[model samples]
Each structure stands twice: as C-alpha cells, then as structure tokens.
Target: MSEFKMEHKNPEGLFVSKAFSQAITVSGKAKTIYIGGQNATNSKGELIGAGDLELQTKQALNNIATILASENASFANLVKLNIYLLSGCDPRIGYKAFQEVAGLLENPPLVTVLFVSEFARPACLLEIDGIAVIEDKD
Candidate 1:
C-alpha cells in the first residue's frame, strides 16, 4: 500500500473543474518531486508550437508528463502546477489545452497561472512546472 494521502478541495465560492483543484493537501511519508519548467521544445531542442498558445501549452504539458514518467510517476501524483504564459498570450487558450490533458487525471492538482514577458527561448509560448508526491517505497 502507498503511504501517501492526497486531498483536493474547492471551497465555497470557488470555481471547480476536473482539470484543476483550487487547493491540494498532501500528508504522510512520500517522495516529493520538483519538476523544472517545461517548454514547448522537442527532444532535439526545437520549438514545437512557435506562435500558438494552445499548441505550445499542450506540448509543454506533454513534456512534463514525459519527465514524470522517467521517475515512474504519473499525473495522479501531481500536487501542484505553475504555468507561465507569454505576456500577450490568452490564458483561456492555454487552459483549454491543459484541460484536454489534465482531465485524464483522477484528481487534478492545485494550479497557478502567470503571464511573463519572455522565456529562455524567444519562440517559446509557455512553460509548466510541477510538484508531485509519490509514496515512499522504502
């Protein structure tokens, strides 16, 4: 059995959705993973969605998923997500794309979205970083 306990919450007066939780509480002995900001770059370090916010968001999320998989973890173990978007990018576009992927998880993680002027790569439209908690096997 896993030693991790995670709870998602959307308190009164807060909007709710399968794609995200307003708050997340985690307890018990677990291994926490902090993932760096993932961009819309492919394995060859080339940008995937140059000027499309939605497409870039999807690619960034996919990158994060691939990184998590390397550690034997999945979106189900994610507790928090921080999304960064290009200053002029529409957040709704990114949100829609994110929902398409995050909705696959049984419980969504808490999230914060921010708009920034630029990124490490000029063509990057967005980036996503995450924190995940997995049961300690040892």
Candidate 2:
C-alpha cells in the first residue's frame, strides 16, 4: 500500500480537492510517471463528441486510460488527476466525472479540477492531465 499526505495548501483555495491535495505529500518510489495534458481526442486524432463537455470529458479520460495502459499502469496506480474545463462545467459535472472514472476501477485516484479560458482544440470542452505510479513489474 502507498501512503499519501498534504505538504501544503494554497491560502486562497476556494474548493481544493482534499484528496488530491493530500496526495502531494505522499511518500513512494523515487521514480514517478507523468501524463501530459490529454485532450478530447482519440488515438486516430479525431475530435470526440464535439461541443459536448460531458462527451469530451469521457473521451479525454479514455485517452488518459490508453496512456496508462501503454505504461503498464492502471487507474489504481493513479495518484492524481488534473482536470481543465473550458467552461459550462459546474461542480456537479466535476463530481459526476469523478464518479465515472472511479467507477472504472477498484481504486480511484484523487482529482483536481480547474477552469481554463480555452483549450488548444476549440472543440475540446475538457482536458485531463495527471500522474500515475505503478510498481515496476520486473
């Protein structure tokens, strides 16, 4: 089992994800895996469910999943999730997506959601960036 902790907190945090914040202080392997910002697109680079935040959110997550799988990682190995929204995503949407992702695994990773002005792809209603750690299957 891995241990998680909270090393610091932002002074003006309005709604910091307690779970995610605590993960910042976790003690684990010196080695870590980083996932770049994954937009709402498929491996084929096709836009997914354009103009729909929920659909885009799902596709972006799918993209993230693929990335993890490629590295022998799973959502259970996820320590943090950083979400970027292009607007229209209320707290409810965030919560719902969290549930959806959690539902995909036996153990879900902590998450943080931040609203952004825009994404590189205009059709991207949402994006996800995160980190996952897995025991190297040597």
Candidate 3:
C-alpha cells in the first residue's frame, strides 16, 4: 500500500481540466525528491533536440520521468514542475508536448513555465525540473 495520499483541487473560481490542477495537497509519511533542471541530453550527454522546442520538451520530460522512476515514483507522484524555454520558442509548442506526455496522470501537478534568453548549452531549447512525493512504505 502507498504511504501517501494526494488531493488535487481546482478552487471554486478556477477552471478545471485533466491538463492540470490548481493545487495539489500531499499528506502522510512521504519522502520528497527535488529534481534539478533536466535538458534534452541523452545518456551519452549528446543533445537530442537542437532547434526544436517540442522535441526538447519531450526529451527533458523523459529525463525527469527516468529520475522519478529511480525512486520508485512516477508522474502521478509529482507535485510541481518548472519549465524553462528559450525566448524565441513558442510556449504552446512546449505545452502541447507536455500535456501529451503528462496529462495522462490522474492528478496533474502544478506547473510554472518561463521564458529565458539562453541556457548552459546554446543548443538547448527547453528544460524542466520537478518535485515529487513518494510514500515511504517502510
């Protein structure tokens, strides 16, 4: 059995949808994991998507998913996500990819997307970081 309980809510005046929740509350004995910004780099450290925002977003989210899996968690355990996109990239492109990959979760986590002029790697078009809560069933 899981050791944590999650409640996702859209406040009285807020819009509702499977894409995301206005807020997510987590309770119980849980372990929190802070994931650093992930980019479109493969295991060999090669950039997966150079000028494509959608591809980069997908790769970055894939990286985060891998990290979450390492701790026995999945997108369902995510409480928050922070996305960074290159200035010229259309936010819609990245968001569309995100929803396709993350919208399947029973409770999508809160998200904050930002536009930045550049990143550590010039070729990087998008990056994503997140926080997840795992039920410590010990």
Tens-digit lDDT string for candidate 2 (16-131): 55344433344544336799998878878899888666677777777887888888766666778888887666656655665686564444456777888887778777778888
Candidate 2 has its poorest 10 consecutive residues by lDDT at: 2-11
Compared with the true structure, all predictions reach lDDT values of: 0.85, 0.68, 0.87
Question: Which parts of model 1 have CA positions greater than 4 angstroms off?
Answer: none
Strongest candidate by lDDT: 3
Candidate 2's C-alpha runs over 4 A off are 1-21, 24-30, 104-108
- Highest-TM-score candidate: 3
How many residue pairs clash per model? 0, 1, 0
RMSD in order of candidates = 1.7, 4.8, 1.6
lDDT of 2 at 121: 77
Worst lDDT 10-window in candidate 3: 97-106
| Per-prediction TM-score to the true structure, in the order listed | 0.89, 0.72, 0.91
Candidate 3, residue 13: lDDT: 89
